[model samples]
Target: MSAPGNPGAPGLAGNSGSPSDRAAQGRAARKRVPRSAHAGWVPSLDRPDPVAVLERQGRDRLPELLPIRYGRMSASPFAFLRGAAAVMATDLAARPHTGLTVQLCGDAHLLNFGLYASPERALLFDLNDFDETFPGPFEWDVKRLAASVVVAARENGHSETKAHRAAVEATAAYRTSMRRLSRLGELAVWYERLDADTLLPLVRSTRHRRRAQSTLTRARRRTSLQALGKLTEVVDGRRRIIQDPPLLEPAGVPDMAALRKIFSDYRSTLSEERRLLLDRYRFVDAARKVVGVGSVGTRCFIVLLAGRDADDPLFLQIKEARKSVLEEHLPSGPYIHPGHRVVAGQRLLQAASDIFLGWMSGPQGRAYYWRQLRDMKGSAEVAGMSPTELTTYARLCGTALARAHARSGDRIAIAAYLGGGDTFDHAIAEFARSYAVQTTTDHTTLGAAIAAGVVTAAPEV
Candidate 1:
């Protein structure tokens, strides 16, 4: 792992050089690695099998849950892409990068950008998943976003031309937004955020605006109190989380005891004020929960707490943290604990984060992070989006990503590297289109493995 001076660590300060000198350095980097060089994606002959990569990932995860992850990934090409971060990280590591570091949402696919409540209770739209976040070149995130866009567009039955266009427009938005943010004061960039309420005005059509408003309303309604009736039941005169096999189940006596112990450990990581506030909420119930595509096999649980009365509830999720998929491919990050790495990365990348965010070590020395389970969280329905709507959403995601990168990366250098041209955007479009094809091929390979009984896959749920 990298030591104290590494830029990948949390609390990274900005480049010390003057703006003009940084800009010149960015320009100089172009001679060694031109922006246009990102145009193609020809898979190497010795590229590891995608299924083998997934199997290797599952080795450390829950054995029974591995089938669900496979089942989820096999549902669609986009689903495979969502669950195949390790595959993409390997491919990206082989490509030329500009060497400009940023705290990456290592799995920055289309669905990963969403709406969630900030600490101040304002609904904000930004990157919501950070399981694979690590420091790497800025273009890695852009390429991942563009590739997901292209894959989503194709899945929506758009022509290849339209898919390519959407990817180009997304990268273009990232470039333009970065350039605009480069001129902003440091504090202004740090404070920038996308308010969910303000997004209604940006929707062009009446139908889309209504959908946008509906989404916002649904997000606001997704609080822990709202989830209480659905996720819990009054059992034998006691309030407890409902047990549903394979998805949600009570942790047995041993696991429950471990959870209770770690619950206290997690409290120590919070601020004194938060610790005091948490002390008021008595622990009520906890259940293992399966969440997300790529994160499916990891150990995850939801703990319910009550304040004052049984009516007032709080749901906190404790998710297992492991070495990032990017770690092996890139230089090691500074964090020794995976949970600390995830929590620190989230704080560095998001505009405003969940106040309940904390981390601790769990049983068997596994690292885990704790955060609210359902605090106004919602993601876009990418599969149903129209071509125009997809393009607009792409722009929103691009802008949000740039705003995040600006906080931890050398935006002036990245903007200068992108220049005032469409070269990088077009290059990324080409790469996305090529990668989308590779994703489909890999998806087929996984399906073939399932058919041949080489791997087990649970029925789609």
Candidate 2:
């Protein structure tokens, strides 16, 4: 791994010597490190042991981290798989690479791609996770994504060939789109996005179309009012969050005295203009909520604000920021604060973002990014999608991923390296199939561990 403060290195394309210059420099240094220098990119599947690879990656902290909750393995093997990202990441890092670097969803499994409403009310399709986003080999994303396809396919009873084909189709789309992007000018590439409507035609199957439509409908309905209706309920004259046990624990309202002090500090984190604007809205309620599979244990809070009238409401989700998993694998610098990295990466990748998207360092030195809680947020039901529909969704994800990569790097050079061929497609397909098999074996290992009482897996909700 490249060390921080390494100078005299080539930078990412279009960096222009701004504050992003150092990040560009770091990416360049990483690229120059020969694949042999890093045991993480081993290509031979048969000789390379996946479990050993995972152990090596987590060797620094494996025993300490293993006792963390393994949620609901008995319900379905897939649930255990969802919580084993650290194990998978280690395994994945030991795989072959196409050597193309981009900002990656380090854990780009099938479930991570989704539809999010932009500030303009336009629903856009994109990668939804940034916790692991960083400059890394493009194949890392595909390997993780393809393995997920196989896992989902196994759960849905699809054949190995069918799952492999879907993963190939997705990989092909990414290659083709990147090649096409190479021919375009920088501004055009930066502006490119795969929106929901544009993706509908590619879906093809009637069953898939119906599922996509249903998800789109639900996402549109998740406006602020809808979120408020679903999440908040009045209890004994005070608005309290409806507790859903471990899934959605009630966090009780913030102590008025504590909030009054914290709000003042929070205000300082905002721009003077946003601070003044926020002053108009009085804080009404706050609650702790557990959300998502990987993020379940992280401290996440939902704050309710009122703007002088009972009808006027705004909801915000303040998720705790922890160190990125990428930090363990890569040498990140002081210039790269995780919160700022997330916000910056989101802006670089997403065509549009929530207007309120911003970050702050808390009183305890914790970092967090704030955004609207449920402003038209929605995601595709991977379990319900037909093979054809999955293919289309995968293509859309690939195209979007390519566009995001083009934003920070030299598309022309990267595309030239790709060379408009199926070499990458075939390689990714092979890797995906192999990795998928590995995921199943690992899932089974986790199940065995749970059954033997080696780990206490959480009960199904």
- The candidate that achieves the highest TM-score relative to the unseen native structure: 1
lDDT at residue 163 of model 2 (Cα atoms): 77
Query: TM-scores, in order shown?
Result: 0.97, 0.83
Worst-scoring 10-residue span by lDDT in model 2: 2-11
lDDT of 2 by residue, 1-461 (tens): 42232222122335344334533443444355422232222334554443343334333332422333344434554554565566665555443343445666666776777888876778888877776666666556666776677667667777878877887788778778877876676678777776887766766677667777888888889877887788778888876567776556655434334444556655665677877777888777777666665555566677788776756788877766566555554445233566666766677777787766666665456666677888777877777566766667677767777777778765655555555557667667766676666667766766676688755556554
Deviation of model 1 at 192, angstroms: 0.5
Model 1 ranges off by over 4 Å:
1-13
Please estimate how well model 1 matches the true structure, expressed as its whole-model Cα lDDT: 0.91
Structural RMSD, model 1 = 2.6
> Which numbered prediction scores highest in lDDT against the true structure?
1
* lDDT score for residue 22 of model 1: 86
Clashes of each: 0, 0
